[model samples]
Target: MNAVVFGAVLCAGVAAWVLCARDEAVRRARTLLVGPWGPPGPGCGVPGLRRLDVRVQALLEPFRVRFGWRLGRELLCLPAGLVLSVAAHSAVPAVLAAGAVPLVGRWLRGRESRALAEERALAAGALCSAVAGDLRAGLAPQGALAGALLREGWPGRPALADAALPLLAAARFGGDVPAALRTAARLDGAQGLAGVAACWQVAVDGGAGLADGLDRIAAALRSERDQREDLRTQLAAPRSTVLMLALLPLFGLVLGAGLGADPVGTLLRTPFGLGCLAAGGLLEWAGLAWTARIVRTAEAS
Candidate 1:
């Protein structure tokens, strides 16, 4: 009798979920067709819910760009938490899992920032080489810069190309090329371009050989890139150690289960076990955060 009731309840829940999803889809379609100001839409009846939805979308925008399909994994946290809550008949694990979503998003953002920095470094080096080659070929500074912009397959090509627009404009109009370069350097993933701007200013103002200056800059950038690579290599062992330590608890849990200890049951059914789980999770999070901070500091230096 209990099994029949449970099955019926599960079927009912699934049916309701499907209905709700269908309704949401239809409402979204209507809103898209009619526009925001058309008629009242889903969540429009509740101002607070609407505001909260907006805030969540804003928060997720950056993560969506960085993680792509991986961002969907974060949304699974809520449902996974609910499943654990049902399986263990406890809410604690569910809440903890749900709370982890933000942390995961933050980690993804950090990875994106690091990648952008590396790309910018590469772009700076490529720009230096291109400019130096152009100068050697007897191209004017403006022509050299334009040619570099047209060159393909560089790490930060998109950003450099955008920066090149204002730069080319300045060069053509006999405006301040140095100032334009500095302005472009302020864009995201273009910080390294400031050095290029400085080199250009010195070459132009001090009557130095621009090609030689660019060559020197390219060499320095290449050396810096090598140093960064070495630093990452040195940090790999510590990162692996931290990851292995974090997984040790899972191994212990699995080992207990294999020994017929019903570790999962105990964790979900007993207050003491639940407390241990939460405490362990908190410690794991803290340790990961600390290790990450140390690594970031090393990278920044």
Candidate 2:
């Protein structure tokens, strides 16, 4: 009698689930057959789903601009969540790993920002050389700048052009060139423009030689770029060492498996093994963070 009652309850639950699923499918089909189709209406059934969707979109805006729409938050978190879930056979660690996706995105953005800075620095040097050459060839300041902008294969051209547009307009209208340049210097990824602005200001205000000033600035920028390259070469060994050390745990895991131990299963299934895994992950993260911080500080200097 007890077995019959249990079977009946199971069958009832399954039937209810099937009915709900069928109703949902029919509702979706009706929506599709009707006009103005997209996701179901905002008012349709699921509690908090709309709010959660809005929140996620809001969070993804910056990342979408940096890393594409498809490759933003979902790409970063989903694989990480899956890997953690598979490794641990648990949801809690997977959620925690997924939560770290933003940090990974932030780090990638930082690297991109630094690379952009370096590119802008190189482009500023090239611009200074080109403008100085044009000025020395008897062109006016406006013509020199315009000619430089026309040059092909100029690094950071898009960003520089965007920043220089206001300056170009001001120059054509006999307006304040220094003020426009200062504004350009305030733009994102245009920090190198500050040096150009300072050179322009001094030449205009003190009746100094703008061409000579630009030439000196170009030389100094090239020197700084060389120094930065040297610094990167010096830091390469240490960075490699840190990366190798981070991989040591993976090596150990592989070695343990080769020795006939069920290392992965032990780590995933046992509380003590989970504790060690978490601790090691934290240490590795800390080490990587410290290395990155040091490298960034050196680059800034």
- The CA lDDT of each predicted structure is 0.66, 0.63
Residues 1-301, candidate 1, lDDT per residue (tens digit)? Answer: 2332343355345433322221222233344543443333223254554454445555665775687633422454566567656765668657876887776546545554555566667877888899899899999998787677557333123324456667767766777878988897886657767878888898888988888888887888899889998998999999999979987886786687667677776776788987887788789879988998999899889
Q: Single out the weakest 10-residue window by summed lDDT for candidate 2.
A: 18-27
Q: lDDT by residue for model 2 over 1-301, one digit each (tens)?
A: 2332343344344333322221222223333443223233223344554444445555666675687652232333554455446554666546765676677556545544565466567877887899999999999987787668557333224334445557667756777777776787676545566777788888878978899988988898889889988998999999889979987886786677677786666776789888887898899889998988998898778
Pull out the clashing pairs in model 2: none
lDDT of 1: 0.66
For every candidate in turn, the CA RMSD to the true structure comes to 11.4, 15.0
- Deviation in Å, model 2, residue 117 alpha carbon: 1.4
- Provide the TM-score for each candidate, comma-separated: 0.71, 0.69
